[model samples]
Target: MAAYTVPKAFPTTVVGSYPKLPSAQEALRRQRKGEISEDEFKRLVREAIRGVIEDYIWAGVDILSDGEQSREDMVVYFAERLRGYAPGEWVRIFDNVYFRKPIIVGRVEWVSPMALDDWEYARSVSGGRPVKVILTGPYTMLEWSFDLHYGDRREAILDLARAIRREVDEYLARGAKYVQIDEPALSTRPWREEAELAGEALEVIFRGVSAKRIVHICFGRIERILPYILDYPVDQFDLEFKNSNFRLLPYLKEYGYDKELGYGVIDVHSLQVESVEEVKKAIDYLMKLDIIGPEKIYIDPDCGLKRLPRRIAREKLRNMVEAAKLARKEWAGEE
Candidate 1:
């Protein structure tokens, strides 16, 4: 078990990305067009992150991220920084939405700390709150991109894992106590080899980090990888629960999974915000299931809130926080 202890149990957090402020969106547009100086762009991004952090605090989140204002896209952000990638053609991730795919063209290397500046600035302004740094894990980076070099997939994956390890080390060295490695791609291909490769990659990235080591995998065949990931070195598994109506609970119960469970109480993909009572009821149900106890539960949204409107995101988070409070009150006797 990890030495890290929660500030408060059932702590509220996010799945890493939150909506960018309108001003920050505009700044990204201008920066891409070279209409603003690099320093000016950095300033705007910091302010945007501050705004999101303020929102999180107001919503009563116990753990916070920078809202990832500095990233355009999760995979793209890391691809742009690492030495091996080049931008490829656009590819559709959803029905109509598309993003430029990254192609590996040379040796993959973590030249420097990609998120140090953003993390340092965010921590400085977080008002004593613990700030977490989120990174796109190696397996996802490999699965999401095109590899024109490093003909062997395992070689490329391990190289990317090394890069992530270095970045995680940087965050730890810089006082970050929480780091979440997002590997949403683990479920994309439900093959044993795929899961095994991801496991090996996670092992490399997760070694020697004493902080709250978290791995987040969502929106896929979670059951397929459950057996493999249950043994992963991370202290917690932050997964999508609400989105799947907690379908995997049975698997977790049957396996007697024993780790911190980042319960997804809010559905970020929905426009209608969850009511506090509704969220509390969901927790009530989870408790009755007796799969995992309240001590190991960490409340959060199903996924990133970047897709939802800012107002809805705030309301959803507020409700999630309220639900956690209400649950704590009901379970007060246990303490």
Candidate 2:
């Protein structure tokens, strides 16, 4: 209903949060059953990651990930891999639904392989299109885990920020030119009382991580907290557009903020494939806005595609890439 106000440019790209393949899932299951040694597990994981990398490339996805499918869940996997962080208990959000929780046991520390392996696998698969190094944002870790540390939540966040900062530095030095810090929960807070808190906390964690920093917020209304997300000093803001928050684009553009936007057009949750026409309509709506355009926009699904059926996910992504090409043709007056 409102006008989109972001700029547009050539060379739009699409990315989604898709999972790894069947082999990776099988290896994880076997390892959990104690049928494989740690070394063997790592070897399997490496092979699985390579597979994911290759698949994304073949699918024409400009950006690639290790699929993150074998990692025992992103946050918990990192908690187990890092020193001074341990699985504590499970926490419930809705009835009978819970996330495996971790606690900060001491000063945060990152063990290798978790960070190193991700970087290396990306390098092995990347044909120089700039693979994104995905890491859980500090705020997200604090939100998902038990915060029984030496001080208040803010204090714990700063500590985590420092630890994440170290990880970012290491990854960057190892040929990681693009990085994604996932903070899907930050937008769920009461924005009025915590805008500065969220903004400042992200400010600290994002400091010194120069490589195309993208803070991803989706699958929730955290839309009400866009003021905070917009305030943070980062390169891009990736948010859900096909889902409920599609209405937020006008407000984002109205504020005259100039950061790049990962404008999600495909619905990741639906098995019903999105038509190229639907994606085009969404893009057309945004393009009509004064602030939004090709240069400032990147196409994506409403959220990660990991939960959807692999076939559906791949189709949605394929449609998205084609949709981008179509948008380019129409925008250039070639269609």
Candidate 3:
């Protein structure tokens, strides 16, 4: 168990996804339709991932991911690897986006490592940059799935928590310094009981894992559960801000948010690339608040950029990195 460290202030990163290339998407379609061999599809996917790594490097992003190129859907990808789960019908998450919801048919179990190979490949291509390993948290996994075996939701979530814990342990053993657990459903839980259970499950998931733990929540107001969630054992809270026009910062300041902040400075749902000036303005706004200093801040997009065009995604990241560098200078009184 070692502590995670960042090299400098306002480090630029992404919230773990890049847009899939059209050729990769077509290859996936062909593989699903049985039009191409599995080996061929995988070769195309590996090539696509290399291109994505290059995109991040070119954009000057300090932290990188595998771009999730091998994954069709976040929750379903892990469900397919774990035991006692089967893919169900497509369920709409939002506009034009859908995933085949997973159905839990029996006791959940971790059969083997799920994202290790992807993380290894990402590290190999990162050119010594720290690759952030992102995982869909247990609570989100259970919430998005149809649980038939564990009739009780709390029981099911805890079981999934243990399964995810195993995966996190494996990542830590393989030299992962930063591991993020995405639990967007934490913001949408309708009941206090569910929220409490989610917090407990998060504790279970990160138990005994020493990597820098981050939890990403997006697309919903977090003021209601921020108090409860802050108690979870994590090193940073990656949140959406640009989409809400920085409305949440004041609330976080008032509540005395003490953990490291993954400040989202770009909106991912839109194709319009934010100018460097716009991003700098957003960073300036946060700095003026004085709630968290530059050392505690991380700059990134509001969410994964998989929905946008590849060109737009790259441009957005490039601007974000530039803005962060400019802000870093201002923080040091160099500007």
RMSD per candidate (Å) reads 2.8, 5.3, 2.7
Better of 1 and 2 by TM-score: 1
Candidates' C-alpha lDDT: 0.86, 0.70, 0.86
lDDT tens readout by residue for model 2, 1-335:
23222124424344434665776777788987999987777677777777666666665666656677567665787788777786777776556856678887776665664656755765675565555777787778778877666457777667776677777877778867667878777777747556566567677767776688788887766557776567677888887888773787777776786788888887776788898788788887887775665766777777677767777877777777677777777775533
Winner by TM-score: 1
How well does model 2 score by local distance difference test? Answer: 0.70
Report the C-alpha lDDT of model 1 over 173-199, residue by residue, as the tens digit. 877788899999998887888888988
User: Would you give me the overall lDDT of model 1?
Assistant: 0.86
Candidate 3: regions farther than 4 A off: 1-7, 35-39, 333-335
Ranking by lDDT: 3, 1, 2
Candidate 1 global TM-score: 0.95
* Model 1 error, position 135 (Å): 0.2
Residue 227, candidate 3: alpha-carbon lDDT: 71
